[model samples]
Target: MASQSLAKIIANQQLNSKDYRLLISAPQIAKEAQVGQFLHLQCKEGIDPLLRRPFSIHDYDRQQGEVAILYRVLGKGTKQLLERRPGQEIDVLGPLGNGFDLTNTADKVVLVAGGIGVAPLVPLAKELIELDKEVAFLLGAANELELLCMGELEQLPLQLKVATIDGSLGHQGYVTELLEELLADSYGQVFACGPEAMLAAVQEITLKAGVEAQLSLEKRMGCGTGACLSCVCKVKVQQGSGFEYQRVCSEGPVFRADEVIFDE
Candidate 1:
């Protein structure tokens, strides 16, 4: 079951002016957390920022009872997180949201990410590697500055492809272009977590390629729990021709590509 705790911040370091990595000692969450799950963090002491900010579970070590949260400071909630120092306690409720399914027959897998959304994929890639699966990681960001977790990702035993809009890195365009080339090689599955437009494009590409894919969605949530019904997304019903709203917090954050109904 999901529970709340005051996770002790072991280190909260700024990777750059915009990105941060917070390592916390939360045994409860660390052992239970799976790839693509998230943490609902109380960004500040007071209620000025009411809703707890949800960040993808970036990385974790069950032995050490630690979890990492890599986040970009896009708004007030995230901006406030920067002030937190080591030795402080952060209120956290997590290992929430459904995680990506790893039980597949596919041995060759492609991992796609956009900006900070790459957080969950790092762990997913590592886990896939341990299972003796061939993994390829494709990452996209506006520029070199937005690319998160490059150091950790580079250390993994997998193929890495990067793309930045300004041509600061690998390819001079979207990372999907890399996926297109890889599709020819007969990969087993694709897993992606990123911007909506990018996910939609990935869904189309993989569907046309006849490859299986799982997508981790991002949404602004009112309550990290299932209550309040704030973070609902349209999903194609299993038995219907139309769509039905699914709770992104409870039903997913990760859902099969065909199940999601992306806005056109």
Candidate 2:
């Protein structure tokens, strides 16, 4: 990874009741970024949390020299991130992890995101649209209050489906429900990111339907550069006899559906 002090914070604002969005001035990273990639953010006070919080690169403006990260305030480290203000310099080590391989696209492309997991998928959707593919986004959240970037995602050049478990908004039930309905029609492949359980559910559904899929994993990572091996997960090799562990922070937060041995 190209290591350097990118930029300071331009804005850190709460996007919802449980989430916050941080806009950083990282021109270099933005200029070379792609969808499905993430950054290892160095929390202020010297990693007192003892790990760099990993977040998907939500959106980036190369022209403006900025990048955005959307995170849910579900833990102490995240809560600290929420307290960061404009002009404070935060160290970030990324544009790390492999992104979606949109090499093959069909007439229809489905992007599935769950909760804060929606962060990576948004950028993926933006790329698919630019490729002239018809895009449908399935977004899932626990309630209306937790639905992130609804307005922003709706503005994308694609069809957006919202699912809430509490039926507070959009289609009721899990995002998998919406995805199952859409897959009945024709779609080339599926791309997803979210809680492991949600991703596993998606994986099972897509695999059974004979559709190709890639899942972006959200794992706690230490030494985001892969030295710690803390983010490793078992992956099934194409022609190997057994599963081996791979670094989620480096090799992927993204992997092909059949390649991963989901945590049970």
Candidate 3:
């Protein structure tokens, strides 16, 4: 279920040079939001940036009736979003898209995030921890400066590993390299959200190891709902030797890692 509301921006703070954390007072959406779900925000008042921008729910405070989204200034839409002040009202269509399924019997779960893809995984980590599941995180970025949200992630009770291309951080390589090493320990399941290259590597690693893995994808969307047919990804069908285009906004943003067909 989804709801549309004019939510008040309670807090909008810059996390880094490019990324920001936006907290909004939207109880209806917060209560219904799940890990891996997103919110579609009408960024500006005018029609200049007419279409809404989709942002993953970074974290949500159920008791406080608030939801937060982590985003970076990538274009006109997000730049407009950044200019919005606290107490300003923004139209939010929320708690959308299919989220990660936590019902599996995976005692040891691993979360892999690349760049700002760490957003949705925050809530998923919290939920998994609450279930008494042992969890670990492999966070990677191009460099230390691009690595976002380390402080918030450290507050959780989980094993954390960092990787960077410039060797200014934990490991001096791709996060997938760290993941490969960790996979040797035999994690029951893995959840990943990152660039296509990262996800493809994760898919190969998980497939070879016979581990269950879910991947969250990022795409340009026209409508957050399925009507616009804007955000679609190729998914491998279960029964056939063919692939089908599935709506990333409605059918998923999360899909089985092995089922995703990444462009080479």
The number of clashing residue pairs in each candidate reads 0, 0, 0
What C-alpha lDDT values do all the predictions have? 0.90, 0.87, 0.90
- Candidate 3 pairs with clashing backbones: none
Over the stretch 167-260, how does candidate 1's per-residue lDDT look in tens digits?
9988999988889999899897999999999999899999999999999998888788899788999999889698899999999999999889
Worst 10 residues of 1 by lDDT: 43-52
Candidate 3 lands at a TM-score of 0.97
Model 3 lDDT on a 0 to 1 scale: 0.90
Clashing pairs in 2: none
TM-score computed on alpha carbons, candidate 2: 0.96
Off by over 4 Å in 1: 47-49
**For model 2, what is the error of residue 7's alpha carbon versus the real structure, in angstroms, after optimal superposition?**
1.8
Report the Cα lDDT for residue 70, model 3.
90
If scored against the real structure, what TM-score would every candidate get?
0.97, 0.96, 0.97
Q: Write the per-residue lDDT of candidate 3 for residues 151-250, one digit (tens) a residue.
A: 8789989999999999999999999999999989969999999888999999999999999999999889987889888889999899988999999999
